[model samples]
Target: MISSRGRKIFVAIAGAAVTIVALLCIFPFWMVVIGSLTPENEIYVRGYSLWPQTFSTEAYKLAFEDPGKILRSYLVTVGITGAGTAVSLFIVSMCGYVLQRPDFKSRNFFTMFVFFTVLFNGGLVPWYILMTNYLHLKDNYLALILPMMVNVFYLIIMKNFMRSIPGALIESAKIDGAGEFYIFLRIVLPLAKPALASIGMFIALNYWNDWRNGMLFMQDETMYPLQYYLYRLLSSLDFLKSAAASTIDLGDQVFPSESFKLAMTVVATGPIILLYPFVQKYFVKGITIGAVKG
Candidate 1:
């Protein structure tokens, strides 16, 4: 019903808006890439540019020269992310399914218990002392996985999504002589794939990006995760003071610290950036399911 001129104008405006937003998001990343490839001396002299005036692989070479540390950290991060996601998804999904069941007695009380923790957390000092002194989890990988096992907000979102499933489905499953665990594993879980995938990615990203836990609990440099290793490298000038310090002499090692920082940032972010597209559909679907159901 619109005139040809008006339709063209509307399309042009929308296209321009999208282009502007896309450029805003992409320009910073481009700058980082250019800056990282730019020689350290050149960056100091010429300042930042969209294109590297003198491109060099020095930063990447320094980063990967003794790939042992980075490789170990990658293994630790992968293990934590995979294990944590599986455990967290299982616990949260099961809890959420039970919480959403209409006939479950004391469900309101259980929900409140979970929700209350979100509002009022135990203080940091107490948590640190408890984990380190009481639980004796310091320097252990469990410290990374156990503390973040259940996120209340995610549980609430999953519960809300589960509530949207027809009660008749669960009732029929029950009548078919299926146990609760069997029903959950076989029927409910399959239907909850979108929510599970979204929450799984959320948990995995948390584990992968976790540097604070490593800093707090892991005293041994060898146990340090990738983010923590990168953090220490970026912040500390005397990188020889920590793990793998003895591998390179302070006098002989020539590290482009600034470019190295940028390079590490790119490496740490690369996985999630690649993963976002694949998981984006589930994320959208999960949010829509939660919003409509909750």
Candidate 2:
């Protein structure tokens, strides 16, 4: 019922508002990048700016001092993220498909069983003891992948989305002698692309950002993910400053501590940021549809 001019004006205003919000979200990241490039002395004197008066690569140089070690850590993280996301997506989608099957008996019981874990968990001590003492995942890559391979929340979202799939299609496939697995792999999966993309992104981000598993279950420096590797670097910096305050002059200008922190953020986040655009369309569609279903 709105006039054409009103609609145009409304859309223009909405577009402008959205652009402002996007810039607001991006501004902090821009500042961090600028801060990383700005010299330690310049930052101390002039604070953060949209553009730096002087630039330095000292922070990046310090971080990559041991290029071999940094590269190894990156490989480990990339491997973990890739493997974990794929495994998680498969397991989650399979479980979702099975749970949403109309003929499956005791589906509600199994669903509740999965849901219960989300509400409560055995405390950290039990979890650590189970991982290290029982599973013997110490210093193992499975330590990184297994624990996070399935999330109950993702399971729920995927199940809800799969429920929207026409049951008649599954029934017809079965009548045509197509097995459940075939139908799932060929038909259901293709139809659930949006949900798969959405949940896959979440799983990838979880594995990418995870540091606790590395901290707790991994002891070998060679196996440490990029996040834990960066965490170790920061921890060492803190320890050095505290323990060697008098004997060592590890001042801000010497170490470029502030800029070093910003540089680490830039390095750790760069690859994952590149991944967002690929899945963004599917992600938006999937989350909205999945969230509203049950």
Candidate 3:
């Protein structure tokens, strides 16, 4: 019903807005990619540019040349993420299912207990001392996995979602001679796929990106995860000095620090980027279900 001129104007404004937002989201990634390809000297002299002035594979080559460290870090991250996600999901889903049951006498008390921890955390110093002295998880991979096993926010969201399911369904399963665990695993979990998927991705991202635990607990170079390793490489002048010092005999084959950092960023981010599309549907579905119900 609009005039041709008005329709054109509306289309132009909408297209311009979309283009601006898209560019804002995409420009940093584009810069990182271009920076990775750029020569170190050019980057150092000229600063970051929208396009690489002089392209080179030296950064990627350096990253892969002694890929042993990077590969080991990747394996550690993958293992932690996989194992942590599985264990945490199991625990969260089970706890949430129980808490959601209307007849569970202690459900209100238990929910308040969890909600209390969200607002009041044991401070960092005491927690650190406990892990190091009593728990003795220092320099251990379990330090990464065990500490983050349950997120209260995720638990609450899941419990609320589970509440939306009919109580008659649980009663019917119980009448069929199903035990609590059996009903939870066989009946509840199958119906809670959307919530599980969303929480799973959240847990996976947490485990994958975790470096604070690694930095605090891990002293051994071999125990370092990818992010912590990259952190040390980027932040420590002594570490870079030692690396460059060790390679001094190679003469003109020095590590490209700037470019290599960009390459590492790409490596660290690549898997999650690839994984987003597959898990995104579940994420949206889970949020919608939880939000609408609670």
TM-score, per-candidate, Cα-based:
0.87, 0.82, 0.90
Cα lDDT for residue 276, candidate 3: 83
lDDT of each residue in 11-61, candidate 2, tens digit only = 999999999999999999899899989998888889878999888987777
* Winning model by TM-score: 3
Report every candidate's CA lDDT. 0.83, 0.83, 0.84
User: Where is model 1 poorest over a 10-residue stretch in terms of lDDT?
Assistant: 240-249
Q: Which of the two candidates, 1 or 3, achieves a greater TM-score against the reference? A: 3
- What number of clashing residue pairs does each candidate have, in the order they appear? 0, 0, 0
The true-versus-predicted C-alpha distance at residue 183 of model 1, in Å, is 1.3
lDDT value for model 2: 0.83
The pairs that clash in candidate 2 are none
Q: After the best TM-score superposition of candidate 2, give how far the Cα of residue 229 lies from its true spot, in angstroms.
A: 2.1
For candidate 1, write residues 65-177 as lDDT tens digits: 67677778888888988999999999999999999888899899999998998789888999999999999999899998888899988899889878778889889989999
Which segments of candidate 1 are over 4 A away from where they belong? 1-14, 240-254, 290-294
TM-score, model 2 to reference: 0.82
**What's the CA error at residue 270 for candidate 2, in Å?**
1.6
Runs off by more than 4 Å, candidate 2: 1-21, 61-65, 238-253, 292-294
Using lDDT as the yardstick, the better of models 1 and 3 is 3
TM-score attained by model 3: 0.90
